[model samples]
Target: PMYFFLANFSFLEICYASTTLPRMLMNLGTQRRRISLVACATQMCFVLMFGVAECLLLAVMAYDRYVAICNPLNYPLVMNHRVCIQLVTGSWTTGIPFLIEYTYQIFSLSFCGSNQINHFFCDVFPILKLACGDTFVNEMLAYMVAVLFGMVPFLLILGSYSKLISIILKLPSVTSQAKAFSTCSSHLMVVILFFGSAIITYLRPNTRHSEGTGKVLSLFYTILTPMFNPMIYSLRN
Candidate 1:
């Protein structure tokens, strides 16, 4: 069931990523492709919504790990049928509103000049960068998104891992500790890649990162990280 669920999520990832990335790729090849205003708005909504949902799912997966390893005896009891419903529902609940805010911000902005976004997908920052008119409102909304979507979930994962590490250290043998660390290290890597790029892009103190750097780093989380998850996890184990 978990496999099926993750497969569905990954399918959505491909659909969502393709909606924007494919357009960008086509534009790169042809040197002239433009999104209709409505298409751009729709693309941004799906991208943002799916991205947020993926994060919530990752956090829930982390919580599942916490329950499974820390209390195996009660794992089934703790993550019961009804509880799983609530968890998945909560992910959608949190994701949908962010989508609304993002789309609202995007629609409110004026795009007069070239609407060519450098990076794949109609991501908030890159789209906002091209907005011709006053983008103060969009910038504020972006900052709010940075806080809610980028930082908070990252802190949640960090906090969970802190306790997870504490529990791992309590294991009696070095071999046991190594085993736990190996399983955890992949998840830790994903969390790092996802949050690291996002924070550097949005929560940046210094805007020294170049356009090339921004595109590459964003690809790590959005395009590459999801692909890496299964490979890294399987290889590590």
Candidate 2:
């Protein structure tokens, strides 16, 4: 059920990325690059919510897998019904706090002059580029987001996978080792595809890049990663 739920979460992520990218591509292709304030705000909200949700859910899934694979006898005892509901509820609950900060920070931004954003979606960095007034608060908020959403979850996933791999290596038989890894291979692959692209594309401290190249690469995690998830996980598994 948690697998399906988290997969559902990723499915929503795919849709969210799809919604913004096409219109952005159309604009970048034909130069119809004008977007309204309302649309930008809405885009900001949806992208932030879904993107953060994906990160949160993936971390949750990793931890769930940790409990199941590394400590099977205790799995049912530990991750019971109440705990599962709390995990899901906590995801949504922790996710909404960003909305309050976004509303205050983004709504207050003055877009008086150039309104052109040079990215596919209204991600914090690209969207902030179009703000008219001082975006110090927005940038600080974005930095906080980078630390909390991007770095922290990544650390959690890494730690979980580390424990998982350690447990797998302890298995006595070669076949058992392979089988242990096989259960998580799908998730491990998904994590690599998503985070690898993200780290390469956006996690850079210096953001200089060429035209269309960055946009194309940005879709790897957002669009292509989700598409690959079911195929790699389900078909292979």
Candidate 3:
């Protein structure tokens, strides 16, 4: 079950990185920084889709580890093939409706002034700043979405890990405890890196000083985390 979840996560990381890096690299190579509204919207949709899916998938992985370590007898029964597939499907599809509406709301607004996006990618706050009209509602909605998809899943992962740690500590032998912790250490590193960067990027105040900081932080989750995931898991092996 762990490997299964990791494989899905690896695939998700590929998709997530592809959503932004190719375009970013092209712009850097050709010096054509301009992006059409349609293209921007498309990028936003995929970025949101894959980003939200990853948050949910990581939570699911945490839950899988909790089940395996805390309920060894029931792990196979609980995390059966059908159940795993359903969880993956739910992770992938859960945020699509909300994200579609969120993307639409962002793009529907007027952008009469300079269309220059402050960031490398067409992220929510960067695009919001470009809109000529009032963006108070959009900002609030973005916050709500971040709390729902980003923070909520993070909390879930934390809860699962809390239980896992308690169970691991209760194990009789040091070797057994080490084994249990080993199963989760890679995932914990990933969760911290990915969610830490994401929370800082989305949940914080967007200010002129922080725009540059946010772009750099965005690279952690969007580019660096994905790049590190395979290495982290493989090193665990």
Q: For each candidate, what is the lDDT? A: 0.73, 0.73, 0.94
Per-residue lDDT tens digits for candidate 2, residues 1-237, read 456556566666666676677777888799877777777777777766666667777788888889988889998888887788777667656766776567557867777766667777666677666677788777777667756876788899999999899988988999998887877787778778877776555555535554365677678866787778878866765
- Using lDDT as the measure, the top candidate is 3
| Model 3 superposed RMSD (Cα) | 0.7
Query: Which digits, one per residue and each the tens of the lDDT, describe model 1 over residues 124-147?
Result: 777877888888777787777777
Q: How close is candidate 2 to the true structure, as a TM-score?
A: 0.86
Off by over 4 Å in 1: 1-9, 205-209
What is the TM-score ranking, best to worst? Answer: 3, 2, 1
Poorest 10 consecutive residues by lDDT, candidate 3: 1-10
Error of 1 at 163 (Å): 0.5
lDDT of 3: 0.94
Candidate 3: give the clashing pairs: none
State candidate 3's TM-score. Answer: 0.99
Q: What is the TM-score of each candidate against the true structure?
A: 0.85, 0.86, 0.99
